[model samples]
Target: MTQSDFAAPSRYFVDESGTTGDLSRAGAGLDFKQQPVFALAAVGVDDEQGLADRLAQIRTRRFPQAAELKSSKGHATTTVVSELLDAIDALGGGILLEVMDKRFTLAATMINTLVMRPVSPDDHKPSALWFRMQLAEQLHDTAPVEVYDAFIQACRNPGEASLKAAFRAVLQLVPPETPRDSPAGAIRLFTLDSLKDYRKAGVSKPEVQRRFLPLPDLGHTGKEVWILPHLSAFTNLYARINKLRDGRLAEVHIVHDDQPYVAEILRSSKQAVEDLAADNKVMALARVDYRFVETGELTFTASTSSPGVQAADLIAGFAMRHTRDALAGSRPSLESLKVFHRLANTLDGAPGFGMNLMLSNRDVLRCGLLPSQVPPMQPS
Candidate 1:
């Protein structure tokens, strides 16, 4: 029953923090607020027995009565968290993490669906993506909060009426009274007109509608069509894993914590990535930073059965708490702060390979946490 009995596969254990429920409730005036941030953490390991043994030793000394390591338990204490970090470091493997702001995500989704659709010939240009990123951030930061609220409501029950309302909400944004030719005024006007055109052209047609709208996918019963944070983080992590092992002889597989509701979608999503990866030219033109490999499998298992998954849970929990507090402008205990710095030190060198903040540039600026604190945004 010991991990030492058999050689371990090249595996990365994964887990997440924060709820993935519908984000529209915050706007529905239902006294609901989803977790402001969502995060996924993956810890890669070449030695299962080494990780298992380290975890076992930690449990034996610090929490003899506990059956398993749960981040929610005392294992998140500064000392225990440090121990877990050390455990990961000892394995000489890499880490991948993703964090997002849910509100900013909704705003970005609305902009992508409404203003930037029908991929123009120019959209493939090198600067198009950067332009869009800036525009999305501007809209998210400056648009009336009602715009996002309405968009969220529409996504929950995407119909002609709701979609119309969402589109109209976007159109209501009035550009600042700046010089007519200024970048600020120009971009706003462009965004407004784009929304108008998209609405006039028919926002409900099948061609336009198939791109992740009509949320809470009734067809799949429990499935949702909106871009879930879990999917984005999961895919991003996979790319990083591939990058970590790009030229290596070993295969990389992921052992994820069981997520019954989203498991099927996760598999389908991975397959979809593989399909996309088949087109080398497209990926190259897009300047994708990583590639998907054919040698690995993504499978789900219970955390109770895998020490690696438990360790990931601990990492995820600490990240969630620390990030949530930092965003709220609250300080952590001295010990937690020390450990957080150490954690940041580990992430500093890896850039995108280690931890990533998926929030908009505007949100990043508003929070004022990244420049001197966390690692800078991944190199484009």
Candidate 2:
């Protein structure tokens, strides 16, 4: 083991709001539309026992009967959140929260798979990400219902056949009626043409075809494979942990709430980061955040057993509720907004380190968050 391994590593506890599920499922009851946002929060504490004691004290004072505290139980009121935030600050801990708009993420995923990814591994470039944001927005708005329906179906029964059908649907898209000369029409046409060309190239490359499809066992597992905002959010949070420390020598050990279904996938993702960090060729193209995470793997514990995870639950609940309200075009309460500002202040002005938002530009604009706090899109 390295010398740094002997040093006490910073510990973080993680919990998530908006359970990960296939967003394509639609019916009279639509979770994606109702929830709209997925949120993950991690709380780092230098003094675990102190944090735990504080949390226990808060519960005793607030809810004398409850065995455990949970935000999902409608217990993360403004007063409770304020106290939790205070305890976090008092214990020299910081919180990181990641929120994503499910619909916007779905649109971006399609563009990422069909448009941005290169046919050959060697042809990938950072510049390809420079302009896809606008295309994702255009595709999300102008796409035919058939296209979305097909993609949803593919997510349900993911395979080579389903992916091919969905990609073909995209390639053969006849955009909805719009004035040909109008700016909107021009964008739709441009998006359609771009997707057709890129997806065509993607389909022809047999070696990388599965990259365009879901995980081989997605249907059987019923786990979320496509449009994984939770995974993206967690990766960003992990990166933020390294960034906040500004040194790779200090190890980071995070204990996340036990998620049986996604545990293996998260470990695999961590291994990919470990592998990519060591590969000179890949690291040359990857961003700075990809490096400096010293921890080799994650540990999981139930929220009930971990104070840090419980603290994270409160923050995630606040973040999810406020963002959902903003997305639905409803004004948030002044108290809620105050707690948000307090949460924002915890980062000490580093934008993406404390809070990350993965919403479309339109959703962001209406979300009532400050312009400076919105995270700039990072290259994939």
Candidate 3:
């Protein structure tokens, strides 16, 4: 198969963060630097909703009570791997999973290099920006090689445009000297500022901060890749649905998971999502569901007797809870997106403040939120 072979459908980008356990708490007493495993993955889909719904059906045992599906585990640290896998399977897509190796200290080092470090005097830039670009390139490069090769091989011929876009997205990151007008350049510029702003706002360090740069924008972009091929199909379906007078052409569907930190990641990543949405000019839609996988009230032995049932029940209950919460009220609607300058004084102390600030603002614009809308808050 070659890039010249197949016709592209509406495409989509799909991704997954975390897995089935509470790895965020893996560092209970250890140095903040030491943490267990967490994973983030991105996949391209031809039919996002259909894929999501199909996966939900397969995992129906996992979410019995969700009024509507949502794809987050409403906590500060955990990844819902099962739900993520279901999503991948349902969408008929391939994945690029980023797993933190237990033996590698790279995760922590990378975080410090990107997030904890205030500014980079050496480059007169924020380390975060550099780190984000590097990370995005790495993931983009490795993932397609490891997983998408099969997809590529399976295709009799793939669309040249998509293949070129995907290849360009990855290639732009490597060689380090690639021109700045590429996707790699965009990622680097976007991430640096995002981290800087996050710190300025005094947002508490996320569990993964010490081990990962937390480039939510990259994750969102990955999802876009999964969705792009299927855009035309979705648009047509949406148009027909509108003719029926059901409601908005856009539909928000969620994939439910039972990981606690998934929700927090989703929340924290909200800024990144908004950034990607704007950069890509697409309506962003996502939600995360988190709940306890264990029944503290029941004895371990009793719970073990019906592990499947217990897990399913817990997930369902949590989904309903979240649905109710979303119905209760709305968050501020995203009216517009823009980038602005941060007072140099506001950025003074941060080591890589300048670079970080610039990238963050860019990401905000990319995600479809106005940088000016983010109020300044001091770092914790």
Number of the top lDDT candidate: 2
Off by over 4 Å in 1: 1-9, 22-34, 118-127, 176-187, 203-206, 209-223, 247-250, 281-290, 293-295, 344-348, 360-380
Question: In model 3, what is the error at residue 291, expressed in angstroms?
Answer: 32
Model 2, 1-380: lDDT tens digits are: 22132222388888999865555653233346477788898887868889889988999999878887889888788888999988877776677777777766766666655445445544334444434455566666667667766776766665556766776676566446876465345444654664566366674565445555434323326555554566667766766665556536346688899887777667766666666656633322222255644653488998878888888898899888888988888988889888977775564644224566667677766766664422333323
Model 2 TM: 0.80
The estimated TM-scores of all candidates read 0.81, 0.80, 0.26
- Give me the displacement of residue 8 in model 2, in angstroms: 12
Query: Judged by lDDT against the true structure, how good is candidate 3?
Result: 0.29
Model 3 per-residue lDDT tens digits across residues 1-380: 11133222223232222232321222332222332222232233456556545544644655456532343444111123344434544444322212222111222222223323334333213344354434433443333232233222212123333323333333343455655566445444534554455446443444323222212211232321111111211222222222222222133222222333333334333333334434543221111111111111111112123222223232322322222222233222222111111111111212111111111333324333344322111111
Better of 1 and 3 by TM-score: 1
Q: Which parts of model 3 are misplaced by more than 4 Å?
A: 1-24, 28-35, 47-92, 102-261, 272-380
Better of 1 and 2 by lDDT: 2
| List of clashing residue pairs for candidate 2 | none
In TM-score terms, candidate 1 sits at 0.81
lDDT of 2 at 184: 47
